[model samples]
Target: MNQLEALKRWTTVVADTGDFQQMEQFRPQDATTNPSLILKAVQKPEYAPLLQQVVAQGKGAEISALMDQLIVRFGCEILTKVPGRVSTEVDARLSFDAAATVARAQRIVALYRAQGVDTASRVLIKVAATWEGIQAAGQLEREGIHTNLTLLFSRCQAIACGDAGVQLISPFVGRIYDWYKKQAGAGWDEAAMAGDNDPGVQSVRSIFDYYKHFGIRTEVMGASFRNVGQILALAGCDLLTIAPDLLAQLQAASGDVPHKLNAAAAQGMALERVHYDEAGFRFALNADAMATEKLAEGIRAFVADAVKLEQLMQAAAV
Candidate 1:
């Protein structure tokens, strides 16, 4: 079997794209989208019509509402292709605001429900893994809305999300790798950090080990992978959201995708349980320079794309 098929035996392969057309070929169990992915998709020639259609329907509505509509429409389309959930992210600008995050998440879920999608089972509202976002997710979870906590870069963030009783946590793999590699500069050793030793892979492994050790029910979906090796290293994760290019690479490469992570094995390891209150969480996050820098960078990038998406919508409205 190809690596993709082999990997599927151990992990639920999720297509991380806003392009539904690409999802059919890989047959990923779930799909994930952020502002950057959606913005990229809507600019494509084939997807331009879909954006125009959404704009036409909500011609005079608030741009933010129309933006939500467009993303939900994409999510709904993605739902038709995949049998499992689709993660639709909340606005990055609201990442630090608990109330606003909850409100926007509710609106996204409501939009999906209006289209007859099963919001309870088939949707994961993606929120940034800020303290406020985690708190907001806890509130939404109580109301029966599932959440996928994204932008997670630290174990503290993962613990907070698990404590919040979120459905899943997406600890970014590639972004962590990027930060460490840039820091290493001339001292970086590509071979040494290639697979299991990769800082990004290690981050996910640490989070996964902790979750399995504590029997935390929140799923761990490794996101923002830099390559197939990172994906292969995390073969047994609950889910791995892969971009189409990497998915294609996996599909074409024939190899044995071994299960590198085992929950039962992780449970046997010595790990201390960690907890974080509001002040503690803030301080913990602030202490990790890499996490702090990357979190801010990721949020800024997403917020910029969101604004660009708005500009596109406005131009389409005109």
Candidate 2:
């Protein structure tokens, strides 16, 4: 079997892109989309019409609302292709306002429901992993909203999400590497730590080990990765949402892609079950530079794209 097929035997592989058209080839179990990915997808020729259609139908409506509709349209299209759920993001602009974020998430879910989509079973509302976002997720979970907490970096964030009863948390893998790479400047080795020894992979492993040790029901889905090695290193994780290029690379290579992470292996690790109250969460997040920089940077990037998406809607309006 190809590595992709073999990897599935041990881990759930999720396609991490707004380009759902690319998913059929890899046959990923589920798909994830963010404002940035969606922004990139709509800029492509084939997807340009999706933007035009949403704009034409929008009839000079609020651009932000149109952006939300467009996001749903893409998700609706994606769901027709995959058997599992699709993650549609709430506006990152609302990341700080818990109630506003909750409201926006409700509207996204409502749009799906209006189309006869019972999203309670087939959707994961992607929210940023801010303290406010975690609280919003807790509220949504009580109302049966399955949330995928995105932009998660630290154990504190993961613990808060699990404590909030979040359905899942996506700890980014690639962006974490970017922060360290920029910081390392010259001392970084190209191959030695490039793939599996990447700092991003290490971050997710820490979260995975802790979760498994504590038996936390919340799923850990590693996201935003830079290489195939990072994905391979995270084998046996609850799920690894990978970009299409990396997914294709993994499918192409022939090798013994062993399971690198699991409950049994995590049992031998020194990490203990993590407990994070508000103060602890703050301190823990502050302690990790990669997590802190990436968390703040991820939020800023999402917010920027969300703003850009709104502008696109306005420009497409006429």
Worst 10 residues of 1 by lDDT: 253-262
Cα lDDT, all candidates: 0.96, 0.87
lDDT accuracy of residue 189 in candidate 1: 100
Across residues 23-139, which tens digit of lDDT does each residue of candidate 1 receive? 999999999999999999999999999999999999899999999999999999999999999999999999999999999999999999999999999999999999999999999
Report the Cα lDDT for candidate 1. Answer: 0.96
Q: Which TM-score value belongs to model 1? A: 0.99
Off by over 4 Å in 2: 267-271
Cα lDDT tens digits for candidate 2, 204-266:
988888888777889999988787778888888999898998888989987777888888777
Candidate 2 has which clashing residue pairs, if any?
none
How close is each model in CA RMSD to the real structure?
0.6, 1.6
Residue 276 lDDT in model 2? 75
* TM-score for all models, in order of appearance: 0.99, 0.95
